[model samples]
Target: MPSRTSRPTRRTALLCAAGLLALPRLQAAPAKKPLPPPPDVWPRPALVPGGVARLSLGPSATRPQAHSGELPLLVVGDAIEWTALVGIALAAPPGEAAITVAAPGEAARRVPYRIVAKKYQEQRLTVSPRTVDLSSEDQARYEREREHLAGVMATFSPAVPAQLHMQVPVPGRRSSSFGLRRIFNGQARNPHSGMDIAAATGTPVRAPLDGRVVDVGDYFFNGGTVWLDHGAGLLSMYCHLSAMDVKPGDQLRAGDAFCKVGATGRVTGPHLHWSVMLNRAMVDPALFIDA
Candidate 1:
């Protein structure tokens, strides 16, 4: 008997060749790109009517411009990334909605987003007939005010707000909520566009964020109202105030007392009607503030 030389079988050689063939494929495979971070939590994204939609614009060397139809949107973030904060109208029908985004040096493109339907509660109340059925003079005044407010709401300034999170303007009970289909007596009216905080008359109403007083006046319905421009298309309104401490062009820091609560407007009692408007749409103020 002689010692047989050890040799690889055909099957062994094929297995070795297969292993060699797999090495380059494993080595040449590229690493997967990382996902982006989530958007800011403030003005929490709610894809419904009377909600704020936070649409990520990805990264860019400069801030991109966005718009809802003809109305410009508030695009915030740095050169590395940008986001569009759009205010969904309370009357917005649920379905597909799109916004136009135009990055620097690039052609504008439309980005479609989905909007879920939301049903708000209806409220019935009994008030003076005079408030509900306006006189001819009051009607004319309201029309004028509406025209003026249209301009105010259309304001889209260059400055972006420092922070999206907001503090409550006053400490009190939430007497009324936004998006309520209010009915006075037996007649129906538009949905309540703001949050009403119940407080004693003369209670200080402070600014929730840094803003410039853009409009202050005694309106026909709102009484003593103050509008604060928080830069970009972000504006906050304080309505039914007894007194206004800040005037147009007056700059105010967060927590600065800008007005006092009152029952001056078409209200049953003293309360602060706080509203947050973005891109001319009156969104639910509760979205920006903690309830």
Candidate 2:
């Protein structure tokens, strides 16, 4: 029997404490992780063809490298959180798509995302029969230009542009929207890959963002074209210009007039055709501009 007022012996107390330790203990549920805030910038996420997808890659000590297929993607942000801006091709099928992320000292992993379908409007126009049915000489010239433009489009510099939003180059009514299919003289042609702005022949065309002139040429189809490399995998093209003020390797700031509107190429009238390319994909330029 134990006395009510007597203290337990040291050995008994120790044994009791040990027994208590052996019993199951309750733990507070792990604190819920806070959700990340939405990105407050241009080029908002649109998980569809011809759209830009913003993928969040968890924190890393160094900038992680990401790629969509073989082409490297543009990864931005700091050590706390990095994000990959993936440009979905207009021809990309609506289904599961993934990008490869490689962080320093870690095995590369695949980050998967989904692409939904989108439909664009169709347009038909009447142009010269000769423009639709090209001559042999003109066809050869077009092939050469196409091959050269492919190399220009593949330009990728190390520095990424600080600003993503672009200003309208030539302020006017939007003549044609992007991804518009066209029927020229009853012959089906490729979908319009750019946003066309209706302006006068001498209307000054300005740079939408800071970039370096990569290629300046008078293409058969594009005409007095100027390609600006905006660093990383982003590039912009201004076509059908009456005059080009900037040459290759020239640096241009936003709002600087680099060319003038014209009907130099195969067109019905004077207009500026602006195209934005990312990761070798011609995405909708409207994505990088304000409505």
- Each candidate: RMSD: 6.5, 9.3
Q: lDDT tens digits, residues 1-291, model 1?
A: 533433456667888999898786546668888989876578888999999998999899988989899988888877777889999999999999999999879999988899999999999988788889999998998999999988888777899898989999999999999999999999999999999999999999999999999999998778899999998899999999999987799999999998999999699889999999999899998888765
* lDDT of model number 1: 0.90
lDDT of all predictions:
0.90, 0.92
lDDT of 2 by residue, 1-291 (tens): 867545567668889999999999899999999999966667878888888999999999999999998998888889999999999988899999999999989999999999999998988899888788999999999999999998999999989888899999999999999989899999988888999999999999999999999999999888889999998999999999999998899999999998999998889999999999999998899999987
| Candidate 2: residue pairs that collide | none
lDDT of 1 at 282: 92
What's the TM for model 2?
0.86
Clashes of 1: 0
Indicate the worst ten consecutive residues by lDDT in candidate 2: 2-11
